[model samples]
Target: MQAAEADLEADPRVAEVVAAARAADVRLVRFEYCDVSGVAHAKAIHVDQLAHKMVEGVGLTRAQMALNLLEQVVPIEGMEPVGEIRLVPDPTTFTVLPWSPGSASVLCDQLDHDRTDWGACPRSFLRRVVDRAAAMGITVQATFENEYYLGTEIDGRFEPVDAPTHAPVYSAIGHDHLDGLMLETVDALTAQGIVVEQCINEYGPGQREISVRHTDALGAADQQLKFRDTVRGVASRHGILASFAAKPYPDEIGSGAHIHFSLWGRAGEGGRSLLYDPAVPGGLSPLGRHFIAGVAEHLPALTALTVPSYNSFRRLVPSAWASSTTAWGYDNREAALRIASPFYRREEASYNIEYKVSDPSANPYLSLGALISCGLDGIQRGLEPGEPSRRDPARLSPEERERGKVRDLPSSMAEALDLLEADAVLVDALGPLLSRCYLAVRRSEHAAFAAADVDFEIRHHYYRF
Candidate 1:
């Protein structure tokens, strides 16, 4: 479904933000977006200056490249002349910066100097994949599960809040400590046409997750990126910080952008999600089986796309809900591929799956596009995906694991990139020019791990800050 038009027609709550921007004479309208690496950044110009340059776009030197996730500038040929990038805002993305006093926010696309899509831009990259899917007469609908940490004021220092000393799940602890800020975050996101289902206190001290219920791959990825910025923006208002570094703390779970999705062919659609089959003992259709099979088989290579950081591997250890192995299971949370509950008799929306390996560190566009590629490959080849990882992973015996034939994901960014380089399918899917640049960035990032003993936050953010 498209973005809700209703939210765009100045609601009272949003009107306040509009008035504030106007009253402040916010001369420039800024369209904010991130590149392939998860860098929080923006490109803006004055109102009068906006129209004149809107079509021409703005430019930033390629020298601005950050290490995988860190904000530090990486060494690149400063003369490469990446040139001007056009910024087109989705009016519906209008949301005032919750933390930036008198400032506002909007989502953007990076275009070439000639007004064409910028292949290297993350949003543009994802948009291209979505367009390709559209050409095939099929559609993918998705939502984001934003997992993160919450630091509260304690003796004037922002620290992890006390855990609720009880069973924590869903929205149980959502309003206990972070109610006010959480509500405001939800409100601001809602005003931006984001359908946030609910907020929850995730496992680990000071950890929380906001589950956004949305549709379409592009919209889901966009909202995920926006929410990352929104959380940081909102937390700053309370003198706290929201970190998206994969594994910010050794003892706590790192943030993740876990995605849930279903696929269909136009109107009547793929006649029901190929991934679900109530007819089977576990309810996975033949087509779905092929898709999951593709995912499982290519997961080793998919590592470069899914868990795309050095520290990202640190969080992949067992028990953190981060799947260390590549396996699929029906309703099994520990497996790398988690299948959703069965949709019985519903001919349109039954089967679906979640790739548990991806983190907030991945370039959503490239990674998700790669997932579609590998899955479709399995479908074309009639690949039959394996059964679920039946035993509790934490207690699985060596024989059981061997019998399950489960393989583990790479332990580092270096290994993942190697796998990606070896995979012709994925490289072709991502495009040579983009793959070369993408792989080049990762290699440089991998080398930095030996640069020094970077802190958890730095290790997690070194590439995309």
Candidate 2:
């Protein structure tokens, strides 16, 4: 307890968080963590106990991390119910819940009895990856551009809120239909310190996309959890359901949570853009090319982390705008890696790469951590990305695609898992404990889906994310 108190006291933000919680009359504080399946789980403490709990942390069963999407514990050694871990809240992430009265939430890291990071903690994994990048004089910034459907649930069925109107994509009418819901959602997010960059109606009948401004790698992952919780909370208050499932409805176009990231030099270098160079084509620096090559080289294995769920495969098809090939191109949405166009007068500042393979079903901390791990490997090895695809790789002749080194992404979760198991780089990055636990949990879910009916799959995934 002394060590825990010392750690909390050392962080200046902890005092401010306590003051804010007291001032806001916060009755309960939720200490939350996202599991490997991307499902958020929490334990609440009364405000009267928050100060103590903040130091001692709330206890969670080690088997909690081993639970699959269906709530069954996967048989992972050392993750049995006999052991206990602490959920230590990160003070910097403290925010009053705008939608839940008298409640506030904070993200947490799983710590062992000695207060050191648990080897299987996803948040800790991201922290390690961030430290690795910092050691090389680099900083990573990222954001998730997520699309979700807003609708009503009746008799265990989901129907879009705008099903009757059938508003056109990106149309003012579509925006008007969801104006109240989106407005409340954005306001709630902003109140919690999340910056809303843009919100628009999407292609599906009741689908919408909202993007937050980018921040440091860890903060970005934290914001993603905040974003999802805020949206779902606000939507429930409005008598609607919000689903970030990769494919909320089988017949409709799938939703995606694309990851956008950029690299910058450390503070000593005045934080210059590491991904930009005026002399290079598309303004991508040699280091940036290496990073892209690294991601492309390991895209298949990366998918096991980025698009981990079984339903995610339904969205990663050819011509779906969810890239199916490990090819990069300038502003090409069909390519797995897209060199996003820079904003006017902000070329260096705005230069970044977008990885299209990710979705909201992924645990942001793990997905982003795996991505950085791969990119850093590329930087260290000086890997070169092959020729950029001018057109969609799916549209190219077989020979042309093969000649350009464009390879198809994994079409199923099993395939992706196999690739993941074989990739030494990613396995090492995840560490032995985390890698084994993650694989067991994901593989269990895959097997359950394979044994169930299509309706079972849809029902379980629709609102879980």
Candidate 3:
């Protein structure tokens, strides 16, 4: 076989994965894929057929890509249920579920009828973006600090597992209350090769943040998808639901899947950071500055993907530490892009950019992919992000913001969608087909929110994600 074909087979790792599953006594294997709404869909196969299914993949409807959070299919052309797509198992993502006995799961990539990459597949879109970055001699590393609410459904109403309205952030009481769930979650994730750096009780009642170690961009995105599933599944074992809704409670701080990223070039044995240089101002290398500039230039339209859901906008206002402004600052939590600099220990590799606008409701693959696209555009054009401020952009005078080119993010999903529709750069990178599919689902989602009450909408979207 040729080198390219051999490399393609490496992704499935069929023989090795099948052996591992058998040794683990995994009777059923779930082929999982995330839809446009960041909702997971799965198909299970018996252990006896796991090997074959890994090679051939499982069949799913084309309409799966068009489904909204409501599970209703949006009428996008060429996405009808009349056709089938293959959910090809990715061997590297295989994980045995500690919460579900005799079962294992692996994330899949969608393949069309002729075995070509599917245009509407979000996972595939991310891979293409990663490949583009690689061609430019850049490597993207990323991780998500996911904040989520641990609550229970009592009498059809959601309540925090241990509501601590007045308790201090990272309070011991809430941590001790949910100790079992948190510890078990760490163990389960560690067993699957996912590094859990830390876990803490966030400011909101029952809200917890689990920080994971950053990895290659593709691996990081896949790890996040698994992290969500692992957290929810482990929470289910404890008899409570773990909801990743952008805003599970209207009055409380919403959960965010804040992303931290850096760019790198190859070095001996591993890679060297390309985003940092102690000699430069703010320790930002030229490549790093250009990349940040690209992100700022595209952020207005990119909001449609990063903060995709209608509820997502509710959490983007000022002082929430979820900056809605399209600006970057050193250590500024109020900017959409916050540059982490002057690393005390490892200055070279530690400087990175934190994108604070996204929530857990976003599909990690597409969001991260779009991020890479913007960064690449910046590098190619040698863009400059203007200025970096420690002060909040909202506090800046109108003339000051205008001079610095700082701007606010779209106030609503409708406005964000409109911005995305007109951004030729982003649309080209996302490809016409996937872009159209995403727009259809989000547009329908916005309309649904317009027609529903807050309570009804929360109930409709809370758990499935």
Tell me the whole-model lDDT of each prediction, alpha carbons only.
Answer: 0.68, 0.92, 0.87
Model 1: per-residue Cα lDDT at residue 310: 72
- Residue-level lDDT of model 1, residues 1-465, one tens digit each, is 222223324344334434555666666566777655656577766544443333344566554433345444554432144544456655456555545655666676766667676555666777766777667665778776767776554553335655445235554544576778888888877755678887787766677778887578887777777777777777777877776667766656677777687767775653445455556876767777777888788989998887787777878877677788886777778788888784456534645678788787776667787787787777778887655687556667777676666787788788889999999878877766567767877777677774757563353562242
| Best-to-worst ranking by TM-score | 2, 3, 1
Q: Residue-wise lDDT of candidate 2 within 1-465, one digit each (tens)?
A: 565456457666766777799899999999999999999999999987776678778999999999999999898998999989999998899999999999999999999999998789999999999999999999999999999988888888899888877888888888888698789999999998899999999999889999999999999999999999999999999898899899888889989999999999987769899999988878999999999999999999999999989999999999889999999999999999999999999999999999999999999999999999999999999999888888988888877777667899999999999999999999999999999999999999999999998789988998898
The reply for model 3, stretches above 4 Å from the true place, is 1-12, 164-166, 267-270
TM-score against native, each model: 0.84, 0.97, 0.96
lDDT of 3 by residue, 171-193 (tens): 77657766888999999999889
What's every prediction's RMSD, in angstroms? 5.7, 1.8, 3.1
Which of candidates 1 and 3 is the stronger one according to lDDT? Answer: 3
Best by TM-score: 2
Candidate 3 achieves a global lDDT of 0.87
Residue 168 lDDT, candidate 3, scale 0-100 = 71
Give the winner by lDDT: 1 or 2. 2
**What lDDT does candidate 1 reach at residue 1?**
27
- The CA lDDT at 369 in model 3 is 95
**Of the candidates shown, which would achieve the greatest lDDT relative to the real structure?**
2
